[model samples]
Target: MGNWSMFTWCFCFAVTLIILIVELGGLQARFPLSWRNFPITYACYAALFCLSASIIYPTTYVQFLSHGRSRDHAIAATTFSCIACLAYATEVAWTRARPGEITGYMATVPGLLKVLETFVACVIFAFISNPYLYQHQPALEWCVAVYSICFILAAVAILLNLGDCTNMLPIPFPSFLSGLALLSVLFYATALVIWPLYQFNEKYGGQPRRSMDVSCSNRHTYYVCAWDRRLAVAILTAINLLAYVADLVYSARLVFVRV
Candidate 1:
């Protein structure tokens, strides 16, 4: 199951990366930002995200829920992914419709909102999965504490960035990128914390019973861990990171060209 989960995650990540590269690098590069191109781009993104989630949700339901684990984390992750897709679509539509409404620092508010939504989603997932860790005592305590702190920081950073944009606070590209980097780190960190719980289950619960049993009774366990759940998270993290990097590069170029 563990090996299968790892494989699933890798496959999903690879496919998503390819799609993103083609969309942002090839398609966006060739097409002007018009209503026609924007819808096409968004439609592709929506399709990919939904397809990936559909692959993930059933595994999550079968593996986690059937094992006395709550489906909250899986549900939260799915919800977040769905909302993230919608937010991206909205951003593309809004930007195409009102290209000149906001420029410079203020221009990033919509993207920042998307980031905020993602953060909220991550926190919800973390909280939902925390109980599994709590069964481990002191280690769980430390993990939960650290996760809470990071979530608070992420929330604060999002609010600060949004406020800066709203107030026209003269934020530079470096500052924006730094905020994004921090958020990315927090996201991956949260994933790291949550992953151990799944590992624990794979190790102790299910068929293993702490006997190093590699055999899985739940066929969906393999799909859940391997392809469906973790892969979605990995792809989402990659997409956020790529978009952040692109925004940073573009903003830096604008600044440099102006000077």
Candidate 2:
């Protein structure tokens, strides 16, 4: 979790510096990528990253530490992370395409949904750390593969749009995005159902609830019990599935309406 916090903070600092330099130096025209897409995309991910670190750090480490300078610093960091999260969220909202405004794809509804789908996948990846959770069964392992495959597709979509390389695609980008979103929805739906069943249903040698196993209950555990993390993954999978469904709807509309 400490490592997670460090990465988040460093990313925020670097992005802040870069944005300041680009804007102050009038370098937007020289940027290789679309200025509009880059900032909106960066803000989306930065908000999510800071939000994740803010939640994970306090839940994973701050509560376990004794009252000291370290704990105080941890608390301070979490607070700042939350503030950064809000700031970035505001940036996204303020710059997003309004009802009548023309803007980059990153500011549109489907694009925002893509950001959310990726972020939820990131959270699911964070929770599914225990190898024993999925390695024991081929079916459970398939669920892991589903998560990875869908995450990769969504990430690639985001990158393609970010780099303004969607024009290089064979089909219209909206059609491509709609197809990808539909595929992700199916993949996540399968994982959402399979993961919880394999992890919680007693019929599969799984716990029916949170386990009392020493490793799970011990403070040394990074986040939560294995069972709880399993539950978290299940929940995040569902959330991502929904986000993809919404993305599919919006992208399909774009293809049909040519908007």
Candidate 3:
């Protein structure tokens, strides 16, 4: 599961580069999914993916290598990954909606926040994929379910907007977006509270002693422990909760102010 997160960024980077090249070459129409929303959505996600990789890879693996070609290669990869993260971030900011400009929903504030919400959920997924992180407790498993369900809903919202299918919904799209954002805020808040309490509270059979554990610092140990992953998930849940709150505010403003 540790290597899985690393692989994800590699795959995302490759696909994103292909998409960018296709759009730049004016061959975007060759693919059915290459609509206006696709590029922005991909860029936003790619930026976060690379940012996570640049931080995680070095922290997890770089210290294990000695002063040799392998360490140098790892450092070089980290540097390039950071540069890629910046490139993707610049692309998102460049394409974001400007004042009085008519653009797709993906270019708007709520839309960009959707990208952040989904990316944080992705990192949460990676952290929780190790069964030892949540398998012992049903409540912990429920937290995982919360993450998955919210991720699916947010992804669906993005796809519907990208496909211009929001018009097919029975409700006004703004109201729909606001409703989903509010629902996400509620769900994520529950996870934010539940995950930390269940993971760190001794009353809940939680660790409550991860700070005193020194096994992770051993040179031979490269993978993060269950305690570390649990803490990571807790922090990420809180982050996504705040993102949903911001998204909800923007969406609500779109409903009322635009009216």
Model number with the top TM-score:
2
> What TM-score, computed on C-alpha atoms, does each candidate reach?
0.37, 0.93, 0.88
TM-score of 3: 0.88
lDDT score for candidate 3 against the true structure: 0.83
lDDT of 1 by residue, 1-259 (tens): 2333334345545655665776676674453333233343334334344544544554544345644335666556556656655655565446442544533232344344334434544634533452542454554454445445544544554444434432453675456545654555565455555545443455533222433433223454423222223334334444444544554454455455553
Model 2 TM-score is 0.93
Write down the lDDT of every candidate, Cα atoms only: 0.45, 0.85, 0.83
Candidate with top lDDT is 2
Cα lDDT, model 1, residue 121: 48
| Model 3 lDDT tens row, 1-259 | 2374468567886887788788689886777673778888888888887888888778777766789998998888888889989998999999999878888899888999998988889878877877877888898888888999999999999989877788899999999999999889888888888888888888997777776455455534456766777888888888899899999999999889953
Consecutive 10-residue window with the lowest summed lDDT within model 3: 212-221
List runs of model 3 lying over 4 Å from the truth: 1-13, 211-220
Global lDDT for candidate 2?
A: 0.85
Query: Comparing 2 and 3 by TM-score, which wins?
Result: 2
Each model's Cα RMSD: 13.2, 1.8, 2.6
Predicted candidate 2 versus true structure: per-residue lDDT over 43-111, tens digit per residue: 988999998898889988888899999999989988999999999999999988998688889899888
* Pairs of residues clashing in candidate 3: none
